[model samples]
Target: MKIRVLIADDEQTFRETFSRVLMEEGFEVTEACDGLQAIDAIRKDPYDVVILDIQMPGADGIKVLRETMSLRPDTRVIMVTAFGTVEMAVEAIKLGASEYVMKPIIFDDVILKIQQQWRYRQLQQENTELKTQLDGQFNIDSIIGEAQSMKHVFETIYKVSGTKSNVLVTGESGTGKEMVARAIHTTSPASSSRFIAINCGAIPEGLIESELFGHLKGSFTGAHVDKKGLFQAAENGTLFLDEIGHMPLSCQVKLLRAVEEREIWPVGSTQPIEINLRLIAATNKRLLEEIKEERFREDLYYRLNVVGIHLPPLRERREDIPKLIHFFMTKYNSEMGKECVHINEDAMQVLINYEWRGNIRELQNVIERAIIFAEGDTIKVSDIGIFNAAAIKNDNDEYDLHNAMRNYERQYIIHVLDKCDGNKSLAAKSLGVGLSSLYRKIDELEINGNRKVTNLA
Candidate 1:
């Protein structure tokens, strides 16, 4: 879209010429002869940029600026002034004018200023869009689960997101501890601020303190420059420490002090810096056991565990498996540009009955892989790559002979198609079946003829 500009001045010649030049430059231009005309034009419609003279008849530029600010605060307003009224332009800036230009108007400089304001507006709009996407991405409703345990977890998140209390999340690996932390931060009072996360277990034992508390130049070997720690970086926001159980006991002492005192002393600095941030710590390990074994400090444990949240492993919430599978299927379908829309009964049974040792992360990976290799819109048992024959047994302690044979037949047809390089005629010839029979079987087996099957053998 062309940038819309409004030129407001008492000089008719200047207004006409300026509007003509802007229109020639591919801008949508509007002319106003004075402050009253400018106010009337602004009330009728919104403009991207407005150029107003500091002095005008009927009403002054200051009155027009005030009305513009009230009517359309987003419009970029530039004040045009002479040497005698430069002070008025300064006052206009304080009242929200974006910029001021000196007259004997240099049209090129004004155009440059308008372009700069336009780019700034574009950047502001992009930032707003990105923030909206992030907010929606981390909203609690985005977390997929309908199990009673998960509902309890959601309730806790809503209850604690409004407070500044420290939170300790306990769960097994791949149980989505960090996701819960983000949901809390995104909905909290400090949602506009940063959310910094560091994995305590991933950093080396010797450098964990420096990573948390920052350091001055020459504080230690290879400390070439000043560094801001995670706590300070997340000031007025949230700091998530993952795998907190792996933090060395030596560093835990200073962390306790910082948490209790709300201040931190950099490695080489004598003075302490006051910090204000919400701390969320997550760990897969059982911290109470670590404390009992003297690997973790008891005092620090109590301080960080002001409010506790425990996420159950995927196996414990078996009822949510189908929901998670569907969510992941939709997610991967969009990302990978595929049309996988359904999981066959046998495949769904196997997915629900399988032991997901790696929890939701594992389940998501399996679904993504299935979507990648699925030959049709429906994902059948053969498309699932991570299960054995025993997984297909029925709940009544009996094997499902019919499903087992159908799975075998599907795999056999896929194997033949793979060998024939997906040539249906050749595969039918090799299998001693007519070409029409092959097509019929393909349709009945829910195979997509437009795509080649990926060999799982």
Candidate 2:
């Protein structure tokens, strides 16, 4: 779709020329001769980018800017001012003008500023939509478990949702760690604000610090603009740091300071920005073990662990399996337009007895796959693939229990490895196993080259 742009200026000649230039660039341009006309036009229709001349006739640029901001805070506005009225342009910016262009406006410069503002607005809209989806997608009821362990988790979440305390969520991979974090944020007083999540293990080591704390223009080799970090972007909201045990130790010192001081110093800036937000960190690894091994900071651990919420593995809560299966079946049936609802008793038994090393997430995937493959109205043992033979044992055929377990183990490891994009260390961490142990399992399961590894180092 063409970007909608509104140009508000008292000067007709300049406005006409700018409108022609922008129209040539494929934007839908609307011209307003005065601030009152601009305000009326804005109220009548929606525009992605608004350019307001500082010396408009009826209401003036500042007044129009204020009105536009009040009406639609998401609208991107740029101020146009004469060389002598640079101060007025700065004032407009302070009042929420996205940017300012000097009068005798060079067409190229105006176009560039408008495009930048348009891109920024697009980003903001996408982020807002994502937050809406997150809030709607996960709730206390969406968690789907009647197990005692989950009930305790729900109770803890209820207690903590009203406070501004930091949270530490510990669980194995596929255990819905981030889902719990989103649930807390969605129910908290700051539910109206952003919930930014970053995986510490996924981002590169060199860029991790800047990504969290932001950077000034020219702060580093590729830092071209002043950028707000995840911490600042999550203002008055919550920042969920997933796989926090993978955070670099160098960054941990600064993180500890940010937690204690409630402020952050950008990568190259001398000044510190005061941050007001809740921090929620998640990890599958034993942080205390990391501390003992000198890989994690003890002080930082204590700071983030102010309110601990531990999620039990699916195997420990075996009774919840049937409930979770029903939930997943209902969810997938609606999503995929499938009617494969009922699970045969044999298939149910197989699922209930199986150790879900990948937790809820793995089970969800299995159900989804089964639904896609099922030919009958009800899901059968064959549709589940892994449980086909085990679920319906033959009298003459040997069970080969060790081989069956090994096959399931191999498949689970590969699933996790794929999820992590072949990052073995992260896969291992998510699997709640030591790096060395993961390597041994990979070797024992003979998953060497068939399952690719992204980084051996």
Candidate 3:
């Protein structure tokens, strides 16, 4: 689309000249006689850039620029038609004008700046569109759980979506850490740019640096051609460093610099290239402990841990199992050409009773397998190959009716109560129950004095 521009100037001759020049340059220009008219036009519709005159009858350029900048922060503003003073230039820029041109109008420089600003605006618009589309495509149903633990995770993603702050997502393996990372980047301001994920634990130690930061041609053995690494690919976007805890100490130093300085040194390149990337890192290990144990750097830890999110294991939130089972059942049922619509009561009991050691990933895998094994209309316990006995044998987690339900409730209440620091009010609010109901249930379960429950409280 052509750039939409609102030309705001007091001089009739200058406005005509400016509109003619911009038209020739392929901009869709809208003329406004003064700052007042410009603001009115912007309020009525969208314009990519607004050119303002410093001295207008009703509103001066500085005042107009401030209003426009606040009202439409993404709009680029350029000052035109002379009235060039150091103070005017300073004020325009402070009010978010992209460029200021003197009145005698070197039309070429003005046009060049407008084009540059328009290109930047186009990139921003594209980014915004992509984010909206991707978010719709990737629904929350993609990740399971409505329990307090899962709600906390979603809340974190929502709160931090607009920033470039480095986020450290800590969870056990298969706890959907990467899914969370993807959601953060998709929801973040940089969603349109790129989302590059690298598993530090998967790459070899010797080539890991090049894999992350790129290398020039002939920089090292087998470096046949110049290459762009993940960081370069993710410029102006988000880079998800998965399994970051496994990164070797040697590579950690360079990673730290890239993250902190927003610059990268390609192998064999003397000059360091700057980058603009949001970092969302994930790990299954406790990085602070890793730092104290000398397995990771303390400085890097602090940088990446500006935001930390802890994801609970699946077994801890078994209430989400029914929802998750149906979600995957629909997904795989459609994919595998099967029509298994419901899990029998016996199968649900088996699932809820099992100690899912591998978390959600393992549950998904088991469900997929059982769907294939189940021969009847409904999924049965026999088809699942998972039960209390299996949970004990494989995961070493013993449970009966009371103990199983207690463990489930303990984890659920503790998870929500952790969010509000054991505040009964907040926990009750989160659970969608009365404060008295939550308190009575806590007492009934005898969790009031339990160490974990008390600590959470």
Candidate 4:
């Protein structure tokens, strides 16, 4: 879309010439004779840039600027003034005029100012979009679970989000401990600020102190410049420490002091830096066990565990499998640009009965892979690749060879069909079978009939 411009001035020659120049430069231009006409034009339509003269009949530029601010505050208004009334132009800026241009207005300079304002507006729009995406991703609604355990977790998050106490989240590796921490931060009073996270296990023991508490110039071998720590970076927001059990015993002492005193002493800095931020820590290791083994400090554990939240593994909450599957399917469908709408009944049953030792993270990966390989709107048992003999055992715990062979045949036929893009003739050619036989097998195996097939010469 072309940039829309409105030129309001008492001089007809100046207004006509400016409008023509802007139009020639690929802008959509409108003209107003005076301040009253400018206000009327603004009320009728919104413009990307407005150029108004300070002195005009019927009304002044200041009144027009106020009206524009009240009606369309986003419109970038540039006040045009002569040498005598430059002070009034300055006053106009305080009243919300975006810029002021001295008369005889150099059209190129005015265009440059308009371009700068346009760029600013574009940046504002991009920032708004990014913030919206972040809010949608981390909000409570984005966390999918309907089980009682998950409901309890949500309740705890809501209760503790309003407080300033430190939170300790305990769970298995893939149970989404970090996700819950983000939900807490997103809903907390400090949501408008940052959320800084660091993995204690990933950082080297020698550098963990400097990484958390910062370092002054020449404090260490590589400390050539002043560095800010996670605590200071997360001021007024949230600092999430993942795998806190891996923090060294020496660093834990300083961390305890920082948490208790609400301050940190940077390396080589004598003065302590006062900090205020909510602390959330997560760990898969049992801190109580670590404490018994003398690896984790008991006092520090208690301090960080003022509020506790535990996420159950996927196997423990089998009832939520269907919801989680559907959620993941929708997410991957949009991301991968596929039309997978649902998981077939047999596929869902296998997923629910199987042991998800890796928890939600593993489930998410499986679903993403299934969506990518699935040939139709419906996800089939073969698409998920869970048809092993051990998984398809009889009630008596015996391997069912007959059922296993049937499943293998089904999976192979689907694979061939997918490779052929649902072209049954080509699939039969690839499988060394007649088209009629392939159709009969498809019927016998109960393959999805809705799969789109294209015929090519």
Q: What are the models' TM-scores? A: 0.82, 0.60, 0.58, 0.83
Give lDDT tens digits, candidate 4, residues 243-303. Answer: 9999999999999999999999999999999999999999999999999999999999999
Off by over 4 Å in 4: 33-46, 55-60, 63-73, 91-96, 389-457
lDDT, candidate 2, at 60: 94
Model 3: ten consecutive residues of lowest lDDT: 448-457
Count of backbone clashes for each model? 0, 0, 2, 0
| Runs off by more than 4 Å, candidate 3 | 1-137, 388-457
> Which residue pairs of candidate 2 clash?
none
lDDT of 1 by residue, 1-457 (tens): 9998999999989889988988899999989998899999999999889999999998899999999999998889999998899999999999999999999998988999999998887888799899888888788888988889999899999999999999999999999898999999998999889999999989998888889999999999999999998989999999999999999988999999999999999999999999999999999999999999999999999999999999999888889988898888888988998988877655676688777879999999989988988876877665778656534434553556876666556656765665565689999999999999999988987765654322221
Candidate 2, lDDT over the whole model? 0.86
In terms of TM-score, how similar is model 2 to the real structure? Answer: 0.60
RMSD of each: 5.5, 13.9, 14.1, 5.2
Instruction: Give the winner by lDDT: 2 or 4.
Output: 4
The global C-alpha lDDT for each of the candidates, from Candidate 1 onward, is 0.87, 0.86, 0.80, 0.88
Q: Write the per-residue lDDT of candidate 2 for residues 403-431, one digit (tens) a residue.
A: 66666676567656645656899989999
lDDT of 4 at 334: 88
User: Where is model 2 more than 4 Å wrong at Cα?
Assistant: 1-133, 388-457
* Residue 67 shift from truth in candidate 3, angstroms: 31
